[model samples]
Target: MNAIDQNAIQTLFTEARTHNVWLDRDVSEQTLRELYHLMHFGPTSMNCQPLRVLFLKSQEAKERLKPALLPGNQEKTMQAPVVAVLGYDTEFYEHLPRMFSHNKEAKSLFEGKPDFINATAFRNSSIQGGYFILAARALGLSAGPMSGFNNAAVDEAFFPDGKVKSNFLCNLGYGDASALFPRQDRFAFDEVCDVL
Candidate 1:
């Protein structure tokens, strides 16, 4: 890439910040569908996609989610255009025979092993969550991803059956740049990376 393109890539990395305030614009459903299409392609261990997203856009749904939030997150979440409940399915590995192995054999790996099931589910679901953030950015939406809520309460309110568990909440919308804090510093490559 040329220097200008390289600079643009850096801007996408450095300028993208977690937004707490948003504009009063609507994000179309088509855009969200497109975002998911892009995000789902991101690789995960065994290609076991475990992220389940509940997009709360209606006032009633937002109200239902309110009681589960941390005091600090309540306002931003409510004000944002969408509050996405990112969750993981407890029974994710049950589908691995179809998703990963392509045969009936992979089911045996997690059939009765609760620990392995939970580990793989949480790990891959978290990867999918990271993909969600990048997808939002690619869609020209700013995102504020937070884990400051009561997961159990969220699950009870949103996932009453208990098959799905809330992992984190992300507020999505067009950000209000004026409300953004000054950009923060980060560690230099030399400080964070080491080559053997």
Candidate 2:
């Protein structure tokens, strides 16, 4: 198979920015659904897809989420067309039988182990959350992913049942280019990687 072109690389990586400000355009529900359809293919441990997303699209939903954001993040989150609450389901193993068909007893492996259960949920969910951001970018949307928020407050407000816990928040929309800072430097390969 052929490799992706430079434009795809630039769009997904080199030119993408973590947008803090958004334009006035709205994000359609159909676009959100498409984003999920693509990102669902991303890999996860045990195929335990624990990541659940709540899109705060209405004023009322954003109001509920506002109290959970850190002061710096509040304004941008309020302005974005959509804010995604990425969550991890503590009881994700219950569906492993359906998700991990190759391993029939996968659910039983995690049922009684609290620590293992939590670890798997958090680990896989974080991976899925990252996948979601890349999926958004791939779909021609800019995203601002932030962790500066009260997870407990978000969980209480959105997922009060105690089954799904908040992981992170990602604001999605057409980004306002004027609000972006100059691209920051990243570590070189040799600085952060090791050849084993």
Candidate 3:
């Protein structure tokens, strides 16, 4: 397979920064729809696609979310053009029959198995969340993914039905580079990975 262009790599990873501050700009609904369209293509185990997003765009919506946020995350999350409440559908297996076309019995395999379900939901939602961040970057938006919040409180506020569980919060907007601190270090391949 051919490598992607350098500019694409830069946008998605090398030059991408986890932004905490944003420009006073708005993210249009069209751009957000496009982001989801791109991110949905990311692969998930058994095509489970557990990750769900609640985009808090209005001031009222952001207000509702504030009580769940950690003090450090409050201001930036409120200021962001969009704050996405990323979640995992607890009953994701219900969609498996439709998603896993090759195996109609896939739903049955996961049914009545809370342990398997929880693990799959958590693991795949994390993968999907990563894809969501990259997709936002690809579409010329910045993201600040954070977890310094009360999960249960967030779930109560945003996902009261209990069908979905909040996984993390991501602030999305056009970033202001002037506010960024110096970039941090990353582990080398030898330090973090093993070449098999």
Candidate 4:
């Protein structure tokens, strides 16, 4: 497969920043749908595809989410065009029969296994969250993914059914780049990776 150009790479990674401040802009419903369509194609373990997103776009919806956020995250998240409550369904294995059609027995592996179910759901959903950010960026939006929130509170407020668990919160919108701090440092490849 051909590699994407440098500009595309920059859009997805290099030039992308974790934006805490949003401009006075709105993310349309169509863009939100398109974002999910692009990210859903990202691969998951055994095609589990357990990531379930709840996009909080309205003032009322964001208000329901307010109490769950940490003080530092509250203002920015409230101001964002969309605050995505990224979660994973504990009952994801039930859908394996439909999602992993090639392997009819895939569902059996996770059924009645609480620890296994939780591990797979969390791991795969986290991977999908990464894809969500890239997809948002590719569509010319900025992302601020944060974990400073009360998980149990959020789950009760939004996913009260208990079938899904909140993984993290990401604020999405047209970023106020001027509000960003100077780019932070990262470990070099040699410091973080080893060639075997």
Q: Against the true structure, whose TM-score is highest?
A: 4
The predicted structure with the larger TM-score, 1 or 3, is 3
Name the candidate that leads on lDDT: 4
Better of 1 and 2 by lDDT: 2
Relative to the true structure, how large is the alpha-carbon lDDT of every model?
Answer: 0.89, 0.95, 0.95, 0.96
Worst 10-residue lDDT window for candidate 4 reads 104-113
Off by over 4 Å in 1: 1-11
**lDDT tens string, model 3, 1-196?**
9999999999999999999899999999999999999999999999999999999999999999999899999999999999999999989999987899899799998889999999999999999999999999999999999999999999999899999999999999999999998999999988989877
Runs of candidate 4 with Cα error greater than 4 angstroms are none
Which residue window of length 10 is worst by lDDT in model 3? Answer: 95-104
* Model 4 Cα lDDT, one tens digit per residue, 123-153: 9999999999999999999999999999999
Quality of model 4 by C-alpha lDDT: 0.96
Clashing pairs in 4: none
Could you give the candidate ranking by lDDT, starting with the highest? 4, 3, 2, 1
In angstroms, how far off is 110's CA in candidate 1? 0.9
TM-score for each candidate, following the candidate numbering: 0.93, 0.98, 0.98, 0.99
Clash count list over all predictions: 0, 0, 0, 0
